[model samples]
Target: MSAVIEVVSVINAATGTVFDLERDVDVHAESLAGSRETATTTTGRRQLTLGDEVTFRARHFGLRWRMTSRISAYNRPHHFVDEQTRGPFRALRHEHHFEDLGDGRTRMTDRMTIRAPFGPVGAVTTRIVLAPYLKRLLTKRAVHIKRLAEQVG
Candidate 1:
């Protein structure tokens, strides 16, 4: 079974600016500093574009993990999709959407679908634990991006 998590954030910045920050590897690293996350591949330090792949290393749930994901779809300041090629999860897909709310505000939505590795038990644990954890992580990332984008905007 696959667990899905969705998060929405409203930023007081332009959609384009927020979109750029979402694709910036450095900004992402900073936002996830608590996890000591780092980019371990060639595209880790650069802004992600279509077909770009980045490998990330981080400590989560007291365990270190490495995941490599690629930019599967990109539509400029509107939306983008990234899917995991290798990771702890059996499968993972994240979609980010940005909407212009007018008057310098943007609504960002993150939708994720992830399947854990342990079959039924993994699915149960994902629903009880991992899903909420990921939602919080996404929330924190969005808040950080909002602050940064507002400062620049």
Candidate 2:
């Protein structure tokens, strides 16, 4: 079974600010510092755009991992999606959405779908273990984005 994890944050910032922060490669590396996550893309830009492909190297759960993902969908100041093209997981997709609250505030949401590879065993493992761990990981990242975005301007 594929597991879906969602986290929502309301931030006192413009949609553009929050959206840019959400897609900044530097911010991502900084936010995942505990995991020592580093991201690099062939395009060599700090901001990710549609069709951009990024490779991530990190250690999680005491295991080193490398994953490559592409910005599959993008709409500036609104929403974007990145899906794992190659990774340990059978499948992974993350959607980042920003909704303008019309008062310099934005509602940002992170929706992630994760699937494991080993059929029944993978399903159960994802449901019982990976899902919760990933949820916490995403939550921490979201909180970091909120804090930094709110501080901007």
Query: How many residue pairs clash per model?
Result: 0, 0
Runs in model 1 with CA error above 4 Å? none
* Candidate 2 least-lDDT 10 residues: 144-153
Which tens-of-lDDT digit does each residue in 101-136 have in candidate 2? 988999999999999999999999999999999889
Q: What residue runs in model 2 are displaced by over 4 Å at the alpha carbon?
A: none
Model 1, CA-based lDDT: 0.92
Q: In terms of TM-score, how similar is model 2 to the real structure?
A: 0.98
Angstrom error of the Cα, residue 57, model 1: value is: 0.4
Let me know the TM-score candidate 1 reaches against the reference structure: 0.96
Identify the candidate with maximal TM-score. Answer: 2
